[model samples]
Target: MEEQLFEATRAGSKRNDAGPSRGGGEMQSTTGATSLKLLLDTNAFIALEPTSTAVERGLEFGAELARLAAEGGHRLYLHEATRRDFARDHDLARRSAHLALAAKYPALSGIPKSALADLLTRLDLPAPPLSESNDAVDLEMLAAVGAAAVDYLVTDDARLRGRARRTGLAENVLPLAEAVQLLRDLSPRPLKPPPAVEHVLSYQLDPHDPIFDSLRDDYPGFDAWFAGVRRAHRPAWIIRHDDGRYAGVMLVKEETDTPYGLPGRLLKVSTLKVTDEAHGRRYGELLLKTLFNHAEHHSHDAIYVTVFERHATLVDLLTAFGFRDHGRSPVGELVLAKGRRPSVQDAALDPLKFHTTFGPPAIDTRAPFFVVPVEPRWHDVLFPDYPGQLSLLTGEHPYGNALRKAYLCNAPTRRVAPGSTLLFYRSRERSAVTVAGVVEDVHVSHLPEEVARYVGRRTVYTLEDITRLCRSARPVLTLLFRQDRLLEPAWSRGELKTAGVLNGHPQSITEVCNEEGRHWLQERLNEQR
Candidate 1:
């Protein structure tokens, strides 16, 4: 009876009647159905592109996905926005390629223009003068997903990911790496349930604010209680995001606060949030993954929560993801339990790993090609030893000789002059003709995550900005995007470790040209020719 009392009274303290944080523990999903409807972000689409050196991994990724769909019953969601983006970008590429041909005849240039116009209209490009809303682009994506009622928005983009978390846009925004691994957790592999980043917000906030004030009633002394819980469990961790200073955090605990004599293994979750001014991102889900780890580490018998009985939306999630209602408290508050019923308890938990790890993902990001002035910030950092950022350097890569292109795009990350260096990473497929590059460049298409970081946000160029910088910035070494592939087809299984790009044992080499970065980029110029 005493235990039941512990579970009973706190039903009201739950997040929106989230049964007061279940006391005792949280359970691993050793037997849960796939209650999530996953929607891939732009990065995922790029990963699926055919030209990526990581193309071989795509086959395995798909196979893993199919396995998950068969067993867990998860519905993969794709937004019209994503499809539209692809269409528009594809149209741009086709038009640009055709225009290049038209340029040879001069007279046909007008024809390509006409074709381009038709392509643009066919893509239904959202007319510019876009919404002034901070996350207008993100909102477009969200509305696209919302219409389909997806359970999660999986992405790695810092800005867009945050927007989803702030507005409660989707069920969760997960990293591409984790998203693939989740698929691997199904049959054929031991179900190793690792800590998951579902609905994680990678920053923190003051609980005293107005929004929190309204939520304070749930935990009369939430701040105090949280401090104590952290001191008790000590599972605090830091998260990293792109172009941001603050790392996201999570405040979760295995609490003793049970509700209404229910099965008491409830893990209390709090402040699964990102700090204010967080570029709306996927931090919410990033933080939740941390708690998932804590619950598993503590070996809690079950997880329970107190939340509003009417949060139909949240309720749908909780129910789908593996939480069950242990019957509401006598006061009419809802009580939820994990590992209670015979339903979804994460079958993956029974195994040692719940997610699969691949070599760093590859991306063929596209942006309008152009010459841009490399900022002093980039030069000073990358080439302090160089006499002049104007010096030209080049290399021949055998890896780029076969299967794809025949030249090395760029060499090691080094400093270059302001107007001297031109950098850009383009998608090989369609959309995003290319992502303009500046000082530092991230070759996600060929490099791993860690190495990519060393190159992350190093560039501060947009298609328009590139033009301004080109006029005066000194010419630095050119970093182009070329193709590299495996000599043998079998090497293509699973994830290609990110390091392979940095150190691969290939057999040939090619010296490439930087014509694409030449003066005056005609939009839609192709890199191949």
Candidate 2:
């Protein structure tokens, strides 16, 4: 939870409270202070265009953010680069309107040329020749954050956020929604919940259902495909709008009864669609995630989809999740596929020659086992099917590329190789060892770009979240592990301590080296039989 920045007084006011020290990329906020400043990205300014359609809900939200911040006594500004980006538009009238949007908020004269040049050389960074060039504008925007010109730089672009984090300005960066939330939380006005009509619900619909016929325009061959759909094929995952209309749908086909012919354990996305109203709301991403969870329950060799080239946004989203371009279909649709390589557990967790010797040495020659701590929230996101009332992680619950993945932040204690056992110690609220898995692959990087590339489209955390988590110099560890199974009855932390399997609560990774610890865990696994 974020530390409260002030104390409410009886006189309908607040006073500055002694809160945690803010440094090293920590969010800074104060009570009754006008120090908080926010800079909007070029796209955010464009989103505020007057002629935008209601379906561009993100644009409306972006405008609302500015109004809220202004009301909350916070200044909304933009880097001078924003003006240049807006001016780049060929449409003179549109460009003028965009510039007008920028005029609403004061512009920060971008980082001084001398300072930018010197810093570029000092940091061994490239300085584009033309100051008004796109690259130069990007650098200027980044320099605004690096020089602490703004308390928070708000943007809808994830790559820009990642870039800011790479340049050691993570805390200064905030996504549009997050920035709005922070401003609202610190606002004097009481926070009001969004209308119930905005909430979308997920439900399953039969493959051959008539409701799906409405989407035939998006999926030209959907009717023919539906006719060939297996009787036992998995039902389509649907998201319904608050008005009870369909917002999005994902039709998946798995198993030997394949759609695209390439047999043996395949998951094909025959159709994925989201209505205009839900375009920027991430409903489509949720449908894709639903497919991932379904694939986890079965052995699928690959997950593939045929999307039209015109669907650029959908294609970009797919590419973010590690989907590769596999030429085109016979009918000329773009084909993308994400192959699921077998994990160590899938091969029965072979101890000998488990992995080539690139990673950390095995704890024991027998098999590596460590009690890894997991935030209860993450535990539920990673193991959603686990028994209990699992709370949704977010509106777009389980964000990122969550296909058989786990994140290790703040410098995990140990770096185990593939085939090593990870006994999940679900900490805080639910203190227990409830799930176990084998590490399939590990990617370590201090560079957010490298980490993002490694994770591809299978991360559960946004780039902003990853930056927040890995604010320190400590490298981020991205573990690609398939959860083998969950313990029927979870082993409480105290129980493990009494059995000498765990000493105290392991703040970092704690190896289960003792023979007694292995025996105890083995007995729990035996219960499954």
Candidate 3:
């Protein structure tokens, strides 16, 4: 069991993203790292605690954590904010942890609550603002890493993942499971091509550090920014650098803040430039990927960039890393957004449109109309974990009335032909970037609400928009007609995951199996097929 854990801790984070994540999309990683500074979020703590089932499985989650920290390959850290967040959100578990810790170390337990809180605070755990935003715990976790000068933080929390990326702290972010995997990569990846600067770097150096003078002119506002960062008293990483060339550098929020409320760990890459002299190697992607692993470890919400439309290709490249596309314009550039609401809804009840299917059976090929996949421009999106989500969605979400109207009736049956629009919301990990799938074949009676939007309308979806849209507006989701395009430069995980509904169904319906994940629907279709 320990062996399995040790190996997991040593594996690369790139491999952990093999499964489907957000917006019915897949994270196909091409880069990763082995040993990284590591931290854990509340969810990670829960999963690793001996009392948790994750430990009972002989996985030995906690012991492995200790081992990683002790071995130096994994720098396991915990922030006060992280612990506090855990205590607040998962009160019972945290209380249990406190009690257990007290029992394990009687002397520590005897410490007063206030003293303990102070001590824990002194221990340097991250605890951000829980009032204006719920990211206090998340930010605290990142701060712990920045304070401890650790390189990674691991957790499954969506918001944390997004936050890590935004603060230029991507290198210190990671997921619990993903961190375990990274522990295995100690051998390191062979040096790749020199990174072509993917984005520009814009930030002033900290004047407190001697090198600040050399870089101050280029970075601009070095003294003020660093002072402000220090004044915040939050855990901001001031890695005084290995070369002694830099005394201390603050790497947090120098770029973007918790995305104007789009949720999850969202970051705007304000500084992504590599030194011009290092231009020969394409290490930017590889390095960023490593940084991203660190960011994921730390639990930020999402990483974003306000790039002009002119850099479409560069944007497309980042899209693959789960760095979702946020539709906002870069300043100094003329940003244009064209929107005309074709369907209007009453302002009060605000009826969001959707569809429903009677039941299912029969149907063979998804070639004509089965599960037409989707293509969200931004691949990486995270969301908060909600209840009743473990069960594969059959129809409308039963937890809320707003969502319930879209649920599918799992029983009664029939042979659905290709082109059946089943609009069911597919949940993304960190962000609820709802993915609506269009049924191309009739296998099981898939949910129809999401289909109404995917196959029903001829509109273009910022695929991740529904997640943001659902929070404020529930549009009148309705579907009409559009010629089926089984194959057209298929790009999207929804097209593949939507098919999972039919293929993953337990009921014996049609011999038509559409289990081809993202590729299931339009995977093999011709451009005109």
Candidate 4:
């Protein structure tokens, strides 16, 4: 039976947007309960606007958010304050742009006077006096939430979020990313399997490949750049879809001389583009991830990109992955750079401080580590670069060795939690338990979309595989872990048996509760130290 759902709302935010349901719409819960109603804060709507400067470099950030909401059966609402904000803006051009985007969501109007009065009293704020003509809209926005006009408010403003939390509406307030993840969990889509990597061939691009034509707008001198890349023997990895079409492309070049003042081996991303059809599906993210791995393997001291200022979405993405603005390039383009080590202090403290940002997960010395077996097929992503073997792992992640994530649906992993040590065992030909790390966070949700949005930004899984995993009622558990330490002289299955750490072949995530098993694994790991 479906459980009853409830919503309480109250708000006076830095940026405000609210709306009522124009139609009963598709906002119905799969379990036949009331669906979540989301209101966009004014800044969110502003972000959707394409600036006059954003020409060929413009991004459709709004479309992706809308898609998630619609697919997840959530109704988008706009507070009447959004309209007032639009009208109050003195910049005619910017106001028009804001209005254009605002038109997409239905605007909510009319509020009960008693509800507004009650909300003001509860919030302990005075009603805007007649003298304060400019303040009524903001008060109205708060009243809308207080009256439960909408279940949640989405915003990017930090101050607004703080205010919401202070007023005991923390759960009702959400960041844009969190809002999308939540909605997806509430309304996950059906599954569709992705094509295997075996089907997609990888090859180096010749300087004269016609494929460069499509990228001319982004890279004006593509041919010249390609010649240099080819001469350096640095291939621009391209992934072809099953239909033998270009899915995405990425180009990287090692630069010794850069205006960004990146010393040593600095890698510059020259091109990263995905076909139009692959936009929301994460084709671009896949290629960019490959470029990161390539840079890491090549011993690049830093990675940087020269992007047009108009490409806000791309810039935001790079920033999210720890790229900092190194000011502007000689060509007047934005110079974003990311280094192996984040700060001078970190380098001074520990030479290999790549993943030390959060430090290692706290250790629970009293508990035994969980020994989980991973198949060879999934090893490339789950555990990259099996020593003495070629590393098929290609991707740039904010968390290097310090933090890694693994997706699980098994019974044992669901029981895993923060501070739990995990000893990973590689199955098949490798047939050894080699790496160990500590768990930092565990996310278990039945919605694939929720899992994807939360971790998909860094996952190795394709969209199809992620969607498929989320399709079933079985919960998808994503384990975020940190501080990976490789075990020297891997413990082979035979070795494990002789040591009494195993009785037979292990198939799932098994906890090492046996005292002997814990001692044996710890002894081996301690030797490396």
Candidate 5:
């Protein structure tokens, strides 16, 4: 069995290596030749080896990593300690065969025993007994990572990850799925954006797909309920990968009477599920964006969802967007609801709080407003819905898909308060204000890594882009905002100057502090509605 597996993997490697380059290297060359060094743990190494049984058993991320390495010119190495651990296997022939297989990759030198022991002590880990070679090897790998020997240490060990978190090395450790996503984010290739959300009848779906399995387990009569929905031809919203696999699904229905004593017409989120593979990619938030946009467009009074407490991530996301806990449902599920009404009381809330509470199309008119100048290149990606663009290249960018987005600039304007109105003025060819958003937060930083962590998945800018911006030694101002409206009949440069909204062609983020200009702009927005 060992020899057969080895031969099978060798054959698979040959097949993989024979494919044409996938433009990763070419893309990198255009962008200053950035590449990552990935250090794989023993389990990650085996799972990623071509044709390995582990890859067949749902370790598909490993295959993705291999492809990325071959195409992107990334270097993948195995820690020398992994080799020693493999040699200790009880099955002599299996051990020998695996050792030979491991020899295919370059080896990362192991840390010295004394240094490893000191590092373990510093991290508050007990030294492993002499007999426990595996534990010692794990310590060595983590020590190397802590010392910044590699860009990342890829592993799936829960305990090891826990230790990493405790020792402040969590950012350097990654599970296979997240590791794959990081590489994808850092890759220079132009990726296809995730598919747009589609509205379809319930009957059009396959209820037995793995995407629905968890929903079935959570609700006893889920299948029967779905069958009824199918018969009624209930409408649903879904997102799928290019290969036709479901990334997310949302089932919603309109309720005329208050189902839970909530006022006005309500849209109940009956089911919202994002596949495990899509968890960290923010597809749930994308689906929520779709749902919120639908409700606002259709003028629904409120939205609600009943989810169990065990789904904490989903619950947290809901609450973050101003969903309030309205107590428990009949089945003991937590009922979260958000109202569409913007009350006088909402005027006092901060920018972030106001937007979260009332959602889009419900901005605080009392807040200050600013006209932010954005270049044409960035305007297209940051606000893809702006009209007249020949083509919008989203590149599977999460920031483009998200209603909540970040913009980075080094303009003189600073201290834009949260809840402040942002008029995104597309400079150059378009030269008009095309989009509007509400500020959620503001951050100023000079370090690229700090800025990266601050904006996170919210910004369309890549690390390289941020690095370039920081090269000028000016502080990068990261503005986090939720897109509120796409202005139709966008206010042009000439019109803005005539209305006193701008004194001249704006080159930076400019405040619209003139009361007459603010009033005129407000009237225009109301007229557009």
Candidate 6:
């Protein structure tokens, strides 16, 4: 059956030398790095063709993929199943044309029946007799990914992606947009980091930009209100993409006369908008992170934003960070407020709850503390504000920009309770504890997809990195934590060892289980205050 299938699909197909070279299925680039093997599903394969009709419908993701493949020296391939899929097309001429077009790309080696069956079982798919050609092809492509036959299976099928996610292959499956983004991330580029949020005068903004279109539509006086803000020289934070387009903006003001009967000096978020193009990049969280950092740095008592109910995404993000709904504004917009002041009752709240409630720089003393050793490379990315390490350009990453971040490791120590205190001990040259954080959640998984989903945008590691980490045999420990503060006058390795906070240097996530060590660490923290 397999031999017949192969012969039937290859009858009129001819190989092209410029395409993937067929051997043991290993392709090498001129750069000496092993080329990343990408298996394209039927839809992606057709859509990615230079002359495909879909290109006219704004399928530029194909162009980006092609550029990445050319520049990055990656190899793209079509699976035998995809060829079979094309052969099944009812239009005889179209079928021949597609097979001819597909022939230009290298065909991935077919999976053996036993291996394919096992993969299907592992992926929780039913055995054979798939009613549709697309369904059969989807299973085959996913099976190829399951066998690690390809680095990634690129597809636009939402149902296929949903299945991959269910089967723990989410990390290996890429929708066109994410695939393009990932490829861009992997491609060689300049060393300049992504742009950080900039504090600018409100007058510097162009109100006519499409970013304000929604705001203008929602509020009749948005344009005039913005003009007044510009006239008053109100401060705003803006994030611009590398291409010099506005990605997000947040307009802010200081109000002494609290509306809705709120207390203390208030920092009102007048307008917070992230452009449609930057939707899934965590620019919203990035903007909020900047806002919270600004409010806390300037010692604002409370922070609030009045948002309409229509913006569900922003509302969910705000409430997740401990912003409470305090009734509605005079114009019917929902008022969400978060108190910045740490209170005595804060110590009683769980570690995660406490950080979210008070917005970091506050930890529950009642929680147990652990010293997690980190290398300088990761330490710099996770704690970008570390005094001496601030100069290191770790590049612009979502994890680095947000207060809520995840740490992935193969540490054997199980059971890091949520709300536990973590002292990030930066190892190597500057061997000392430099950062503190409170745990929000803890999970252990050997599956890369599960780890990726759990960490979401909170992780600094790429999916490729996560896959490699999972391949180490040991289960990956994901620590979801909120960064609390940079430890001032960082406790040195020598000091920690002397104080019994460490018996030498911590090689893994070590707990300060001893009373002496805990007490000594507490005294040091108290001294810093």
TM-score winner among the candidates?
5
Better of 1 and 2 by TM-score: 2
Better of 2 and 3 by TM-score: 2
Q: Model 3, range 1-529, lDDT digits (tens) per residue?
A: 0000000000111111112221221111123112234455556655555554343432444455555444533334455454444445446865767545423311101112343244235445454244334554555455554443334566666556555544544434654543543332232233222111122122233335454454455446756665665565432222222343332222334224444454444433432333321221222333443344334445554445554544433343344333444456534422221111112342222111111110011111232332221111121111011233321122121111111111112223344433444322222332122322233222121221132122211112211222223233222222222111112233234443465534332221123344454244334332222
Poorest stretch of ten by lDDT in candidate 4: 2-11
Clashing pairs in 6: none
lDDT of each: 0.33, 0.57, 0.33, 0.55, 0.70, 0.70
- What lDDT does candidate 4 reach at residue 496? 88
Off by over 4 Å in 4: 1-28, 31-72, 83-223, 227-233, 241-245, 256-261, 275-277, 325-327, 341-353, 356-422, 425-478, 481-529
Q: Give candidate 6's error at residue 149 in angstroms.
A: 20
Per-residue lDDT tens digits of candidate 2, residues 200-318? Answer: 22233444444466567766876666666644455665666656666667777654575545446888887787764454344555565566556655756678899887665577567
For candidate 3, give the lDDT. 0.33
**Per-model TM-score versus the true fold:** 0.26, 0.56, 0.26, 0.52, 0.71, 0.66
Q: Is candidate 2 or candidate 5 better by TM-score?
A: 5
Clashing pairs in 5: 193-396, 351-419
Q: List the residue pairs that clash in candidate 2.
A: 320-457, 321-457, 400-459, 401-457, 401-458, 401-459
Lowest lDDT sum, 10 consecutive residues, model 6, at 1-10
- For model 1, residues 340-371, the per-residue Cα lDDT tens digits are 22224433232111110100011121222222
Residue 523 local lDDT, model 2: 67
Better of 2 and 6 by lDDT: 6
RMSD of 3: 24.0
**TM-score of decoy 2:** 0.56
Please write out the lDDT profile of model 5 over residues 206-290, one tens digit for every residue: 7877789888888899888989988877778888866787889988888868888999888998889987677556677778877
lDDT of 4 by residue, 323-377 (tens): 7788887768898887763443643432113332212211333445777777655
